[model samples]
Target: MSISATEGVGPSLWGLGATTSAKTQQDKDMFLQLLVAQLRYQDPMNPTDSSQFLAQSAQFTSLEKMEEVAAQTAAMVQAQLAFGASSLVGTTVTYATGPAGDDGSPAPTATGVVDGVTFGSQGPVLSIDGTDVALAALHTVTRPGIGPDAGTAAATPADD
Candidate 1:
């Protein structure tokens, strides 16, 4: 016996009637339910191939593992950004203020001591003289009382 094209492929089969932006536990549960339903309603005279079933299970497992790894990686990156930003506290930094000039002129910048660091959705931001500056906007870092020519350190994004 053959299954109809619309029988197992409809949204109703996976309980996906509700729209969602991201995958949730409900979605995973629905996927499992769909798989079970397929098995329960299949033609027993011609059972699903064992290898095909194993491949589908493997794909599900791989997808779950990949999502876990992605979440972990994001957390690690956030922690690293926080650590790097914290280190900038108490150091004088020059950071870009406005957009860069298009006529071969250098972008305007402001120099101040980093008073604190704050983490936001966009990553770490440095608090300097009552202004918030993104970590990525940092041009140089120096010790207190040190001039740019005397001892300037370049700021770059941290790598794994």
Candidate 2:
């Protein structure tokens, strides 16, 4: 197919740019096609190393598994933060996160722990403890935080 000038390229071998704008599956397809073509045209005297090929294949599989694990970890952290944030909406809590940094950290908003959540609104707004803040305001939501032990005195924190 002819590359259009408005599409950023006029002409090229394979009619494609070297940019990584292509999808992951497309990269996988190209890799497999190239591997097969190489195998079909390789010199018998200088054949590809079997062990090296197996190692590269293993690396690709490991990459996929790691990516999956990372995605799962992100989802878990988000769920944990959401649960922690929601649970705060019934307690009296005042906290401090940090100065809203150059990259849009929030301007230290502190509200009662047990407050009404705006329906269909975006971002974290409440604070339950020092640094145990609204998840949306955070760049990182840690594993559900363990706060002060309000044991046989007053109150236990977010251990649940």
Candidate 3:
């Protein structure tokens, strides 16, 4: 006998009306939990057939994998945040090389922390105690608290 078309794919036991909002990460978890409970209490005589059960199991597994990937992404973002944070420590910068600082004297280097992040991925601005400058706009970086050595790199010319 052909199984009913409604078999195994009908409204969930939680009685949520058919809505498209049930596809987000949180909803995926809830649906997996509900599917688990459904399997646990299904009638034995007409056991949830292997094919149907396996399909639902696959859905849950895929959802779990997506969650893992999301978690890894979050961790990578955190690590980048930490790296960006440490970039500001002792960065002995002289903002006196760009078109803005054309006289050739290094701008006053400031010692400070990454007060905040403004643009995304374009790099953050470094706030040295009292100086505010974009990391991208940095003229040169040296030891945490020392200006770039004029002897080793002053006349090398900007990288081609």
lDDT of 1 by residue, 105-155 (tens): 998999999999988999999999999999999999997767645766779
Q: By lDDT, who's the top model here?
A: 1
lDDT of 3 by residue, 1-160 (tens): 7643234553464333443244653465567567767877899898888898888878766765666677679768767865774665665555532353577765554334444434345445566655656665655556633444444534656786
* TM-scores of all predicted structures: 0.69, 0.50, 0.40
- In model 2, the runs with Cα more than 4 Å from the true position are 1-22, 95-110, 116-160
* True lDDT of residue 159, candidate 2: 75
lDDT of 2: 0.54
The order of the candidates by lDDT, greatest first, is 1, 3, 2
Model 1 poorest 10 in a row by lDDT: 13-22
10 residues in a row with least lDDT, candidate 2 = 5-14
Alpha carbon lDDT of each predicted model = 0.81, 0.54, 0.58
Native RMSD of candidate 1 (Å): 10.1
Q: How accurate locally is residue 128 in candidate 3, as Cα lDDT from 0 to 100? A: 62
Give per-candidate clash totals. Answer: 0, 1, 1
